[model samples]
Target: MKDLFHKSLSRRSFLRYIAATMATTAVDWFKIEAMASTVEPKSDYPVVVIGAGIGGLVAATYLAKNGFPVTVIEQHDVPGGYVTSFERGEFKFDVAPHYTLGLSPFLEYLGIQEKVELVKPPEFFRVITPEHDLILPQEDPRGIIRVLSEKFPHEEQGIKSFMSLLNGLLQEWVKPFDMKTISSTHPIMWNLSKLNTAQVFDQHFKDPRLKAVLCIFGSGFGLPPSRLPALVFSPGTAASIYVGREYVKPCGQGFSNALMQAIENNRGRVILKTEVESILAKDGTVTGVRTTNGKTYTAKAVISNASAPATFEKMLSPGHVPDSYMAKLRTYRPSHSYFLVWLGLNKELRGKFKGFQNVVIPEHYDPEDDDKATSACNASKTRFQVYIYDALYSGYSKPGKSTVKILMQCGYRPWKHFEADYFAGKKEAYRKEKDRIAQILIERAESKVIPGLKSMIEVMDAATPLTHRRYTKNPEGAVLGYEHSMDNYWIYRNKNRTPIKGLYLASAWGSPGGGVNPVVRGGQSAFTDLMLDWAKIK
Candidate 1:
């Protein structure tokens, strides 16, 4: 009966049609308010954007500035994906540490730098272990080198050479997809150092302690250096010292404020709390999106920042997607998700170690051996990238207080250890698990840094994979989108626009490969395609 109704009206029935057995009115209204359209007339935006993430918002803002009408749809109640913050009795905590590294260049390009304030935190990242407690100072390469030299006096050359090569690599490594040349000789430096993270640390350094420290660095992305593509090692590591020792939004620049204000400024409409059940397609082409609340959004093109797998696997008709596209999609692995621990302290964690981040590496960590263990879930030891980011905004927390967010990556099997009933219910079930994990993080934090951290916490919270998917719409709640190695980084990255016509992809999985810079870079690639359509009318 439902199929008959769907096929009978075809185009006219598109505005509203559904299964009577399902509760259409019970759809998530918060989602609709975030992504739905409010304009009464069937107005068409030159570019229709889906998922108002960092990439989508940056693209939408630019297109609108050029006098193009735009509409952005998101599945969450808020616009910013990982670039967000929440409040608890005058205390606010960030879900993701999105400040510092990529914010300046990316935001400045959009001319919206003034829109969000970026402040430089005292330290970037700290490393604490039984052997060494390293403080990564701001841009003091000699100081850094001296510190490492003392740790591994015999392996000083290895440390110095590694940093030199990594620096040279980062400066020459930024080859966006748009760059036509990718030859080994492109950087054309008087001195060239080509050592993938694994090669440099493993081949040259023999000390287990030194190898553990360097290899453990890859744990920043929840993967070992051996698993990370060699090319990214340069920019990836150098970014921390060279680019990372910089600035970030205080309470986190509120990526939504940046995008929403741009929408209002450009006169673009943003709707929220609505759900898009499916993309109506005809003869392998996108016709429009059918909101669960009976609203439809249509245009010449649709840009989906939602997870590619979710869209093709669940949202679109299987008949419409070609077999080859389906095959390639299957080959692409969804990256691992995170088990995050969010915290709000009664008073600011002050003193020397305060306002610092710690990437705690477990004792006896090895590079070559760690990746395999982590992948197989045989990791007896682990590491964490800690961000001691307190209130960036003036009022997010009362004066003299701060908040810290700690992120660690793990397999879904941990939380999914039991039946669905274990965590199957409203958002509250997830919240309870959050409390469970929050204790672990705080306990671990106290052991690493403070003697009594549990007492320091006035407020505590946690977010699970379910929470990640609920907000980001990421498949399986993957954080860095797709996990890649040297073998997968190149061809594995899909083109900005897929074979799906009038539908473009602009998310972490799309291009540039996750993080703030890559998301916007991927968005620009899709926008280039959008400009071609705009040129037609001009």
Candidate 2:
């Protein structure tokens, strides 16, 4: 089943979108207190974690398993942040696509790997455009590169150089992925940083079209290649070159389940539906947190998997925080959010499409076009990047049913497009937009594949920026942390350590930015910070 995710990653294959399909049973993480043993451990334990999302959970698991008791608190009924799923009658929607999944060394360091379910997809990304398309097999990125070179023969040189660079960066390293640690110790990274992603592309990629294709990898961070540091792309591309740069995990059953299991298996405590509204801070050091409900739990150290802005803005007293840190949070740009079309269909799409992922780039579309599109959406009119999930995930496909999910990437800015008069709540607005955009998207995709998919309506649903905000607590509904702007990406990418003493930031909001793989890597880095040096008292 996991191999399906790897295989579907090849952009040229239509078989990736095939899915087995679902229903409306709500998973209550709270009631499953059985998962939480009768023994309430971690009393007076060293660390207290805020938000049981991926980063927080990983950090908690590592700390607890290493003999330090840890407590993980969450605002939601369930954990996993965006990496969770919900069922509506026969349809199940994975709110976000998480691919290239990996559990960092931190998992092994804590020795809880067996408690979690982890699998590497056979391959990760499948690239598609009207002009050229391909099925990039895992460990065979050259196949996709050939397709790109074949598409634009005049740009073969640029294409080859681009793929080579990306492949080298994403390769699995014997060393853990860490932006801060590696920059100081790894000479390879030091040399790579000489040229930022933009400078590298300008220096080698003469073909603008090829540049657009190669740089799309930057999308892993909600960034464009031109703006990213070459160092960021280096490690990022290494993984993509091997498996097409995308991987998928079940947010509901797979990801969240693994997180909770790991936490409990390590003797840690997880409490959900409890939002930590304010941190109980003293002078300049640490303490515990007070949930909005007024319950307070004390601990020696606090780690946050919440977004950098939320932790600083809402949790800690603004006065205790550094002015510099506050300014960084206040001004930090959140990532571009998304709009989704989730569908439950009655037919098998395996034969209809060869790839699990299909990407459509309009003729001569400029990579910068993404910037303009997101900006326009910030104001009113917004364009979209179409993601068709029809071929690879058989898990979503029931015995006789299939699922079709499409993604329309829009900026969080345009969420205000709904007039204040018609601002209807999240659920209401989502229902209205589902019909309107679903029709348009059906027309667009049907013309490309299903011939008449516009009529194949069994079930349909939509999610707007507001939905992302409500579910993920992403401010302004930004899907992937802060938006990646040229001026801010390098500096704005937060560090794992925060100014508030005894606290650290994990997850995509910090270094390594967003995407499941990098965040996993970020978890490993965060653990090293806690155990290796930071805690080794002289």
* Predicted structure with the largest lDDT when compared to the true one: 1
What TM-score goes with each of the models? 0.82, 0.81
Tens digits of lDDT, candidate 1, 1-538: 0121123333222212111101112233233222223322224545677777777786677666655678887777777788777777767777776644545544555566787676655654467867888876654556677787888899887777777665555434432222244454445221222334566566568787877776544554555665566555555556555544443555544656776788768877666676677877787678778777778877667777778887788778778888898887788777777777766676665553543567777765665454444443332355655666642334445666667777766665555543255346544555566676666666777788656667777776777766677677686677777765453454446766677777777777776567765676666666665554444433
Q: Give the true-structure RMSD of model 1.
A: 13.4
Residues 368-444, model 2: lDDT tens digits: 76666655442122223334343555565665556666666676655566634334553466466546765776666
Candidate 2 stretches with Cα past 4 Å from truth are 1-44, 101-124, 167-196, 243-252, 378-390, 393-395, 417-434, 484-492, 532-538
Worst lDDT run of 10 residues, candidate 2, spans 16-25
lDDT accuracy of residue 205 in candidate 2: 65
Candidate 1 runs further than 4 Å off = 1-45, 174-184, 187-196, 245-247, 352-355, 367-380, 391-396, 417-419, 426-436, 490-492, 533-538
Error at 8, model 1, angstroms? 68
